[model samples]
Structure formats: C-alpha cells, structure tokens
Target: MSDGERRDMGSKLSFGRGRPGRTAVTLPDCDVPLAEMPSPSLLRDDLPLPEMSQPEIVRYFTNLACLNYSVDTGFYPLGSCSMKYNPKLHEDLARLSGFAQVHPLQPIETVQGALALMHELQGFLAEITGMHAVSLAPAAGAHGELTSILTVRAYLEHRGESRHKVLVPDSAHGTNLATVSTAGFQCLPIASDARGNTDLAALAEALDEDVAALMLTLPNTLGLFDQNIVQIAQMVHETGAQLYCDGANLNALLGQVKIGDLGFDVVQMNLHKTFSTPHGGGGPGAGPVAVKAHLAPFLPSPFVGQAANGAYVFEEPEHSIGKVGAFHGNFGIMVRAYAYIRSLGAPGLREVSENAVLNANYLLACLREAYDLPYERRCLHEVVFSGSRQRAKGVHTSDVAKRLIDYGFHPPTVYFPLIVDEALMIEPTETESKETLDAFCEAMLVIAREAEEEPELLRSAPHDAPLRRLDEAAAARHPVLRWQREDQA
Candidate 1:
C-alpha cells in the first residue's frame, strides 16, 4: 500500500455514524429509581462527542500512534533537549507497586521507604553536582530555573542586599531570560565570543553590586564548554554576586566536572535530561536544585534528609523558598532517575558522558564538510551546524529538517539559540549505536546533496509524513485546540 493511502485511511476524523438512538454499548437497566435529571438550564445541550465501540476506539488510537515519531522508534538528535532512548528497566522499576502506589500526601512515618529513596537520591545528586544541598521539588527544567533564581533572591535578601538584576549569557538556555523575569529580576544579556564562549570582556562590564547572580549553562546551549568558567565564577564572586548554573547541559559533564566545584553557588539539574526519563510531550520532569552551604537554607522546602538516629525524614530548611511542587515533585520521574543512577554507578556514569561526547564529535566530523560549523571546535554533547551553505541554494534549516523526516528520522532542532544563521542543532545521545549514527550521517549527506541538486525537494519536504507541510505560523497564532463539528464551526 502507498504511504498516502495509509495516511488517508488513518485521517478519517469521524469513526462511526451518529444515527439517533445508536449506542456503542448497552447499559444495564437501572436497579432502582433513576435520579432526577438536572434542570435544562444547568445542563449542556447537543454535546459533541465521538461515538465508537471500544474496539473501534482502540484501533483509531493505535493507528494514530503509528503516525507519531518517538525515541523508541528512531534516532532523535534534538540538540539541548537530550532526546536519549530511555532504558526499559527503569520503567519496570517505576511500575513496582511499592513505588507506584504510595500517595504523595501519606504521613511521613508511613512513607519512610519512599522518603529514604528520595533522601538517598538527594545525596547522590549533591555528590554529583558538588553542592551541599538538593531539592526534589520544581516540576520541570524551567521550574527548576525559576526555583534557582528565587533561591538566589531569597539568599540575597536574607543577607541584607538588594540586587535587582540577574545576568544571563546569550548562549544560555532559552528559558533563562523568562525565568529571570519571572523571579522579578532584570535579565542582563552577556555576549558570546567568536569561539562561542561567554564574552569575558562583556561579562566584566556587566557585573556590578546590583547584580544578584550570573545564570550560565555549562557546555552552554551551543554545546561548547566555557573554558573560562572558573575565571567567570571568580569574577562574579568578586562583585559579591553568585553564579547560578543551569544544568540543562549537565549530560556533557557527568562525572567529569561538578558545577559546585567550578565555584557556582547554585545549580539546577534536569533529571529528565541527564538522568533517564521519558521526557517528551511536556510532562513528568524533576528539576532538583543543588546549592552551596551558604545558600542551602534558601532551597525549596521538604527535601529528604537523614535524622540523628539514621532514620529518613522530610526536613524543611529554616529559610526555604517554599514548596515548588505538591510532594517531592513527580515521584515517578524520580524513580526512573534513581533507577538509572543505581544501574550505572560512578564509573558507568562517567562512561555515559564519554560516549555521549564521542558520538557528538563523531557525527560532527562526519557532517562538518557538508554543513558549516560556526565554532569549528570540539563540541561536548551536541553540535550546531549552520545551514547557510544550503541556504545560498534556497534551502533553509527547516527545509533540511523536514527532508530528514522522509529519510526515516526525526529532525534535529532548527533556528535555536537565536545566534547562528539557519542553525541546525543535533545531539545524538550516548544511547545511539555507531551503526545508527552512520545511517543518520548517510541520510544527512544525501539530503545535503539533494539540497544542491534538487532544492525544491527540500522546499516542499516530508511528503512521506502522515500530514503535509503546514502553515506553522498560523497554526501557532490561531491554534484549533479542540475538535469542532462542522455545524458548530
């Protein structure tokens, strides 16, 4: 069967004819008198809902699932997102009844085991990041960023300082500016040098007494580790300002260098990215913040700790930033992260980083000839290539990405960090094998050649996807979030 035919078969929005009195299931007769219906004014009329039998509904969703791309299905070099394939063993562990069934609101005494796991995980994270404290609250990476900024604010206020600005590098995660503003601080942008490192001269000019903290991404969004990080930390500290590490790129430095050791006062690690978790579709993340001894008091509340007698307990710091999550944040995600850590001890964790770096460099070497490497240096865990070479031929980064879908792979992120012209950020995580990497390189090379020989193919690409190219701007500006019946529309 043709791909178009399959897509057409799956694209039928209506599953069953909505004839009057037609029912998908036969409900049993009421055992007793039926309750009185609500008044007409209080009830919704002409409700629009799909009517399908259980089997039909299952088939519809099953077909829809086949249309979507996933980490399990293919290579996902989604740059800073760290779209690594999650290990199934972690999923199995998270599903265990003891871990899965425990209520977040259970009494502390009744949930000692869960608390113990969290406490131990906290310790592991502290050891990993070289921080004196850790908080398992904050639901996602952005939440963690906000939590870290707030912690910095609380610490500054407690110390009788009134710093109103937080410095963020141009190459920091896209969320840093928003997080800084959300925490009620002015976001001061630090420039990136020609080599993609933070421009030290610009940073020095920006640092002052009114600056509360410098929010930085280690191995930053460009995937280049700042060689002057220690010096940068020293410079920020000299001005009585703190260094806040955005651990979004922590995957590149696992067991290699701890952020706290680099003189950072606060750090937030994305458990969903560095540790193993099913992180896509905007859900189920744990971004635990680690702080130095001086800032430990201002961490998010209710972190697990060991008591004097060695029993596990939930301890809130004296000067906490308050609760960032309901209960220890996304316990299921924590379970998966814990499992990933335990399965891979310190050395194994180090090897994960090593292989991740190796894979990224390997792919970088393969495609640099075909694409433009703006930095022209070693990348830690991901490589950003400019599509300007192809753009001259009327092919942009988005065009290259869409063409990748036709070659049976998910596209890398495009036009990100807002620095590079026609940027294509690709991060092939440690989980991918050499064979898979080679296949992706081959596909990329083919697409690059096609971009020159047949530019129109790149322009109107992804002809193989279930849907054709969409008006992305309109889709975002005026999204149709829900299904609307033709009559209703």
Candidate 2:
C-alpha cells in the first residue's frame, strides 16, 4: 500500500483484515500430561487476538509509530510538563540485570545492593532539596501532593489540632485543589498580584490556625517564581501551618536552591520531570516526597536506611502514613532518576537549570510581539502567552496550536492556569539546541503572519498532517478504545 492511501484510510490497521490464514506463531503439541480443560463459562469466547504474519505485524506497528510523536522524535515544548529528552544512558543503566531483573518480593538481605541504591538516592534527594528525609512511595506528582496532604493531617492530629483548610494560589496546578479536596480539606484560593506573584495580602488573611498547609508551586503555573516565597513560608509557619512545596518546577531550580532552606516543611519531587525519566501518557512516574525532621516521623514506611551493621535495610517510620504504593514505588523509575543525578553532579545539574531558564527567556523574547505575554517578566523554565492577539485576527489559540502540527512540531500547553484570557504555556527544555528553538520561533512567526493574512488557514489547520481536525468532544464522550469487526470498512 502507498503512504498516501494508508494515511487516508486511517492509521489504525486491524491486524487480520488484509491477510487471511496467517499466523505469527505456531504452538507445539503438549510435551507433558495435560490438565483437564476449564469450563466454557470461565473461558472468554472472543479474545480479539490479532492474527497476522510476522512481517505484517511489524510493519503495522512501525507505521503507527511513525504517525505518533514523542520527545525522542521531535521538539516537545510542553509547559509545566517538562517533556525533556531522557538520556539513553539512564535507560541502559535501568535495564541492567542487577536492577531490572530483581523481584520486589526478594529478601532485603539478598537485595542489599538495590537497597543501597535506594538509600543513597534518598540521601541525594534530601540533600538536593535540603530536607532531612525522603520517601520514594508516591507514584506521580499529584499522588505526591496527596501523600503530603495526608501527612499534614496526621501531623496536625498528632498535635491535637483541628486544622482543616489548605491555601493554594490561583495560579497553582489544578491538581493541588483536587488533592486538597481528596484529602478531606477545604481548599482556599489565594489570588496573584498584577506582577504574577502570589498576593501577599490575600495569603496573610488566609493564613490562620485552621489552615493545615499552604501549598505553593515555587515557580507557579505561569512559570514565574514567586518572589515572596520566603515571606509566605514564614507567615504560614507563624500561623501554626506547614508549608508544602509542589516541586513540579524543580527543573528551573535544580542545583541553584533547595526547598527546605526556603522554609518549606514538605516537598514532592517529580522523578520523571526534573530528573529525566520517560514520562507522559498517564504513565509510570515517581513523585518522592521529602520532609523536614519534624515531619519525618509521618513519612511512608519501608524506606531504605543503613542498619547498625552498616548494611542497607528497609526501615519503617514510627508514626507512618502507611504504605502509599505496593513494594518500594516505581523502582525502574527510581533507577532512571538515580542514574540522572549521578551522571550530572551538582555543577552539571545547575547548568541544566540555567540553560532551561535561558531557553525559555529566548522564546519569550522572540514571540512576545506575536503573542501577548500576560506577565512581561523574567520567566523560569516556561513562559505563558495570551492568544488574544491571534483571536483578534479570528485565529484562536487552538488554531495556532493545530497549525503548529503542520509546521512539524507539537503544540505547547494551551488554555491552562485558567487566569489568562487564552494561555499558551511554552517550556523549551534545556535538551533542545538553539537551532530547534529558532525553528520553533520561526514557525510561530509564520503562523502569526498567516493569522493576519490568511485567517481561514489558521482556523482549519494541520493541513499537512495525516489526519485533519477531529471532533474532540465526540471522541471524548464516545471513545472507541478497541478495534472490532464492525469498525472495519
């Protein structure tokens, strides 16, 4: 089949449609005594198994892979998501038999080497964040928030206090509010000032004995580092509340600053984001939560520690939050993160953050004229721009995003933080070279001009892509998750 025909016919090729009487594998007759067959009711009638020759199967998947996009393939300037290039070296180290083949159920005495890695990783994370201890239990950034919130509840209960509120900035990640609600706490929104910093007055009024924690994203959703973070932490601490730092933007501060020193009582690090692990597509993530000495007692148990014999062992905290995950939490991801840290020592990690900030600022400067920058200040790893300029020309933010697809690039985040009129959040991670940045900027410039000169092109974009604009609402509401005979035309 030709490429154009394949694209026009839809990328999903049902495995057995084109070929009949084809099989990739052939099973041999049973060599041992066979057991009695199970009941028909217990067996599935239709397994929907794909039947195809080996070559056909490989080609089908290869074609589908080409249709998809990933960080390995192109520039993914996803803001707040930190879709940076994960080093292949980390992948190699993570796949080593010593790390990859070990089962979690093995005795601690036998897996001392793995335990040692985890113990050293814990210490490295704690030292990096200026925390006393770390727990590699939570599975993702949002899960980390939930774990921290639960710990706060436990700490407040231990103090015999009834604090039930959590303060979050208006520009905070939406996950913060959801996490607070899930933890059975009232979430109050603190407004951002005109300069995109957290409104100090609003935060002051919000802080009270009833507030359990103040959840702040250091460099918030808009990618602006809160200038008054120290003051905010002090205020929250004075009111008998803990300060929880969402370490999602740690990419912008990697080796430059530590959260614990900045007065945060608890923090959660995204191993997949800042530390370079394969992430996205709702996947395998590690969000290790770190805490000060006071809150260390409430951390999740089974943490790796040095035993009296100077050997690593699993140690449980006295007043623990219980197990948040099975086993020791995404060991594969932890391995990748540990590899990343070891590969880049303190100085190299600092350079990572420095280049990230520089790249973001460069993009901001190049595209500020085309897009309206809501907060015209220096940004960290990402920058948020408004699409009101394009909208005025009858091209919405979504239009520009779709047009980017035709330009051979994935779109940056859009319509997020819910504060800007039409937000276009862009994060050019440090992994990208200057040439990629310039190409992306050139695409945006071209799109801006097209929006003015040819509004219709912007409205209906992705002209060169394999697929055109889809009915997103319908797809969401009535998702076709699997292929069936009826779907075959």
Candidate 3:
C-alpha cells in the first residue's frame, strides 16, 4: 500500500488479512501428556487474534514507529522537561553485561561493583547539590518530591511537631501541590509577584508554625529564576518550616549554584531531566532526594554505604521511610545519570548550564518582538512567552503550537505556569546549535505573522501532519482505549 493509504488505515488492527492456516509462530508437538484445559466458561471463543506472518507484523509496527516524533529526529524545545538528547555512550554503559545482567536479588558481596557505582553516584549527587546525604531511591521527579515531603514529615514528627500545612507557590508544578496533599499536609498556594518571583508579602502572610514546608520549583515553571530565593528560604526557616527544592529545573543551575548552599533543607533532583537520561513516555526515571544533616536520618532506606573495610553495602537510615519501591530505585536510569555526571565532569557540566542559558536568552531576544514577554528579565534555561499577540488575531496558544508541527518542529509547552495569559514556554537545551535555534526562531516568527494574515490556517493547523487537529477535549473526556473490529464496535 502507498504511504498515504497506510496513514489513513493506521488505526485499524491487523486481523482481516490472515488466511485460515496462516500463523506468526509454529509450536513444536507436545512431548508429554497434555494437561487438562480450564472449564468451558473460563475460555472465550469470540476473542479474535491477529494471524499475520512475522514480516508483516514487524512491518506494521515499524510503520507506526516512523509516525512518532522523537528527540533523535528533531529539536525538542519542551520547557521544564529537559527533553534533550541522551548520549549513546551512556546507553552502551548501562547495557554492559556486568551492569545490565545482574539481578537485584543478588547477594551484596556478589554485586560489589554495582554497589560501588551506586555509592559513588550518591556521593556525586551529594557533592553536586552540596547536600549532606543523598538517597537514590525515589523513582521519578514527582516521586522524589513525595519522598522529600515524607522525610520532612518524619523529621517534624520526630521533633514532636505537628505542622499540617505545606506552602506551594502558584508558579510550582502541579505535582508539587499533589505531593504536599499526598503526604497528608494541606496545600496552601502562594501567589507570584509581578516580576514572576514568589510574592514575598503573600508568602509572609501565609507563613506560620503550622506550615510544614515550602515547596519551590527553582527557576520555577515560568523558566525564570527567583532572584529572591535566598530571602524566601530564610522566611521559611524562620517559621520553623523546612524548605523543599523541586530541582526539575536544575538543568539551568548544574554547576552555577547548589540548592543546599542556598539554604534549602531538602531538594529532589530529576536525574532523568538534568542528568541526560531519556525522559517521557511514562519513564523509568530517577529522582534522588538530597537532604541536610538534620533531615538525613529520615531519608528513604537502602541507600548505598561504604564500610571501613572499603566494601560497598546497602544501609538504612536511622529514621527511615522504608523502601519506596521494590528495589533501590530504577537501576538502569541511575547508570545513565552516573555516566552523564562522570562524562561531563565539573567544567563540562558548567558549560552545559552556560550554553542552556545563552540559547534560551537568544530565543527570547529573537522572538520577544513577535510574542509577548511575560516576565522581562534574564531567563535561565528556558523562556516563557505569551501568545496574547497571536490570540489578538484569534489564534490561541494551542493553535500556535499546532502550526509549529507543520514547520517540522515539536511545539514547546503552552498555556502553562497558568500566570501568563497565553504561555508559550520554550526550553532550548545546550545540545542544539545556533543554526537549529535560528531555524526554530524563524518558524515561530513565521507562525506569528501567519496568525495575523491567515488566522484560519492556525485555527485548523497541522495540515502537513498525517492527522489533523483532533478533538482533544473529547479524547480526554471519553477515551477509546481498546480496539475492536467495526462490526463489534
């Protein structure tokens, strides 16, 4: 079939073309006596199984894979996601037999090398974040947030304190609020100032002994760093509350600053985000939680420790939160992150942040005239622009995002950080070259111009894509998750 025809029938199953005797697999004859099958009621004869040959099945899935966009295929300027390209070297290292083949249940003495790697990774993360202890137990970025909150609760309870509120900034990620509530604390939202920093007056008004912690997303969701972070930390500490840093934006501060030194009591790093691991697609992620000395005792269990005999071993904290997962976090993701840190070293890591900041500012400078700047300041690793200018021509931020697909680029995040009217948050990671940045900027500008001249085109966009604009709301509210033949449907 032609490509267009294939695309049109992409959603259909592979059930119809199979001949009566065709099969993808051929099983050998049973060598022993057959076991009795289950009762008749337990089996369903109506279920249809696809019977395409092996090659046909492979070709069908391969064609589907080609339709998907990936960071490997193009520039992904996804803000706050740090969806940069992962190094192939790391992939190779993680797949080595010594690392990949070992079972998690192996005796500690038998897997000393893997334990040593984890031990060194813990120390490396501690040194990078300037924290007293690090626990590579949380499975993902949001998992790290939940872990840190639980640790804070444990520490507070140990002190016989019953702080029941967690202050979350209006600019924080949705997971921050959810983490707070999930940890059994009420989430109190703090507003952002006009300059895009946390509103100090509002935070001061909200601070009290009852506040357990203040969860701040450093550089926040707007992709703008809070200049008042130092003062903000002090305020939280004064109210007898811990300060939690959601270090998802740590890409903007790799070697520039350490959250521990910034007075944060605890911080969670998304190794998958900042450390160059593959992200998204419902990750196998690593979000290690780091803490100061006071909160160290409450860290999650099974952190790597070194004995005086120079052997690596697993040890639990004095006031542990127990195992957060079946094993010590995602081992494969940890390997990738460890490789990322060691390969980059200190200076290369610093350069990562510098280039990330420069690329973001470059895009900001090039496109500010075409779009609305929500916060007029130097952004760190990403820039959040308003699509209000395009909206004035009846093209919303989502429309602008859809138009970018036709320009052969994945759209940056839109209508997020909620504070901006028509938020277009863009993060051009350090990996992209100037040529790529310039191309993206040009496409964005072209889209802006088209918004004015051909608003309808933006409204019904992605004309070049295999599928046009979908009913996103309908898809969300009433999803069709399973597939069936038309007659059954």
The top-ranked prediction according to lDDT is: 3
lDDT of each: 0.90, 0.90, 0.91
Indicate the residue-level lDDT of 32 in model 1: 98
Q: lDDT at 397 for candidate 2? A: 93
After superposition, candidate 3 runs with Cα above 4 Å error: 1-3, 25-44
If both were scored by lDDT, which would come out higher, candidate 1 or candidate 3? 3
User: Candidate 1 lDDT, tens digit per residue, 1-489?
Assistant: 368756775566753434445556898988998787777677875785667666766666777677778998999999999998899999889999988998877877888888888888999999999999889898899999999999989999999999999998887777999999998999899999999999999999999999999999988888999999989989999999999999998999999998889999999999999997988988788899999999899898887888899888888899998888776788899889988999999998999899999999999999999999999799999999999999999999999999998999999989987899999999999999999999999999999999999999999998888777878999999999987678777
The global Cα lDDT (0 to 1) of model 3 is: 0.91
In model 3, which residue pairs have backbone atoms overlapping below 3 Å? Answer: none
Candidate 2 lDDT (Cα, 0 to 1): 0.90
Residue 306's lDDT in candidate 3: 90
Give the alpha carbon lDDT tens digit for every residue of 391-437 in model 2: 98878999999999999999999999789888999999999999999
lDDT of 3 at 377: 91
Report the candidate with higher lDDT, 1 versus 2: 2
Candidate 3 lDDT, 294-376, residue by residue in tens: 99999999989999999888999999989898888899998998999999999999999999999999999999999999788
